[model samples]
Target: MQAYKLAEQALVGKRNADTVALAMYFVPQPVSRKDGFRRTVNIKANPMGFATGSNLNFDLGLPKLMAKAKPVFCEAFRLEGHYESKSGYPTTVSVQSDSDGDFKVVSMQRLFPNVSQDSLQQLHGELAQQYASAIKAGIAKLEMKTPRVELRFMHPIMIQGAGAGSDEASKLFQAHWQQGWMEFKGKNIGLLGAMKTVADHNKNSVPACKPQVLTLN
Candidate 1:
């Protein structure tokens, strides 16, 4: 399956999660021409999408991956809630937020036209209602529990092909320790545990997974 499809599936059932990644970039808009006609003017948009940020760099492929997945995820969320694309291209969706600035539902729209607008809009309304109902249930769950901090390991490394005569064994060992320090500095919970879980999920085959610590403050 395509990476975008995989991301969409992963995001389908998420609730109260900030699924949208925000970045900064410029957008071109039509302005008055010098001869009293019209011209295109470039203006900076606030909290630009990942694609725009990546566009500024020639060597980076991050934006390309993000661009591909943006629409798939947008449609998936639209099936659950409201999304308003402020700028037509590099679509940016404004999600409704509660008075406390918490999102009631995930908000985003596709930048490309690969999906039908009507289908996406209809899905958005349906998803929004479902999200609202889920929020109520979530509130009840939270009220029943004492708030506490919990951590889980997200990524771990494994030693492979380590031997006395291996050409790069010592270098690999050094790199592992260096990475371990970086992961430890982030105060990640179950860093090792998460790695083990993922390793087992991948059938003990080593896959490179970048660990990021998500802190709820």
Candidate 2:
């Protein structure tokens, strides 16, 4: 209850703050069923920004209400800041891995096809590296104890503002936990828990048997 109040207070008057926006994601977990088979659940968390005109807004009060009602969600969501600009580079990429330790980029697409190959590759590498780092960190933090993981980018990640270029942006995103730079209104949640919160926020319904990603508006 108190956490939601603080978060709301922090978000006050920040609706139109467009230069940078705070974003959060819920961590995913694996569940075992009665059939002796294991599978990941609720991986379709929506990616949203708190800035005005985005999927969420402070006036809706859902974000705050969610923060208060879902302690597990609060404990599991990962928070980060998006420094966006008109010059930002946007792209989408998907990653997959198996129990045999086989990992690779499944597919990638540049939002602007006219962009140079060098620019595209640079953006691709940065996106790939960021996702890989996040996945590995989530696995370690949550102690999921699984050697296999999968990630699919449902939305384009914007790279802009300071050090928006490939090399600099990579460094900035890789070291995303510098407390003094990012804002935290409530309790600090682990990567796994954050992912779960996002899933619930997006209302992802887990299937009876396998893991799947669903796109929600």
Candidate 3:
């Protein structure tokens, strides 16, 4: 149920929840009495009586849920809102049609070319070991795309459907991912690690990390 709602919200965002911000959905727990299971008596209903979904608190936990569900972009150029990479957030993201009503997300790109949810779940489980800080702060939304076209022999796709087979397509995708929280975990020192250097620096002490220079040869 939680996963369903998470995916649902990735598409609809705050639109539907806004309509039900005032309601509350109660999942009453069972308690053991001196005889058997005890239940509640007549709970007061709203003045309008029970609507189909009038008892749910759709406005709850949106932030944490969104933070957990990464933004997925399967196709290029589907981004309807601005992605803020440096800041780790998105703005005005496009939503699927309201008529579908199940609240499923089909356009959000939050994974890489071959990455799977199972792999992510495993990686997330390991967060407590080496990436404890990321686990505590939450893993940044990931981007696992080619990000651009290379002139290698195995290449087969075009740059955003353009004939140009350079790094332009990857750069464009990076621009979109950059608009949100793009996670870099494998190597290259990464943007987050670089930024942390400034935070970890001091005038009086030695640096915790050394400089690394990278070049694409």
Question: What are the models' TM-scores?
Answer: 0.18, 0.19, 0.17
TM-score result, candidate 2: 0.19
CA lDDT, candidate 3, residue 5: 43
Candidates, ranked, TM-score: 2, 1, 3
- List the RMSD of every prediction in angstroms: 22.6, 18.6, 22.0
How do the residues 141-204 of candidate 1 rate in per-residue lDDT, one tens digit apiece? 1111112111111111222222223334333333433333233322333334433443344332
Cα lDDT of candidate 2 equals 0.30
* Model 2 CA lDDT for position 34: 21
Candidate 1 structure, TM-score to reference: 0.18
Write model 2 residue lDDT over 1-217, tens digit each, in one string. 3433333333432332221222222222323232222222222343331122211111123334434332222221222112212654233333222111122232332232223556555555565566554333331111111221222321111122222336544454445433221222123443233345444543333222123468795
Instruction: Give lDDT for model 3.
Output: 0.28
Better of 1 and 2 by TM-score: 2
lDDT at position 206, candidate 1? 19
Model 1 residue 72 CA deviation in Å: 15
Best-fitting candidate, measured by TM-score? 2
- Candidate No. with top lDDT: 2
In candidate 3, stretches whose alpha carbon ends up further than 4 angstroms from where it belongs are 1-165, 185-217
Off by over 4 Å in 1: 12-59, 63-175, 180-196, 199-217
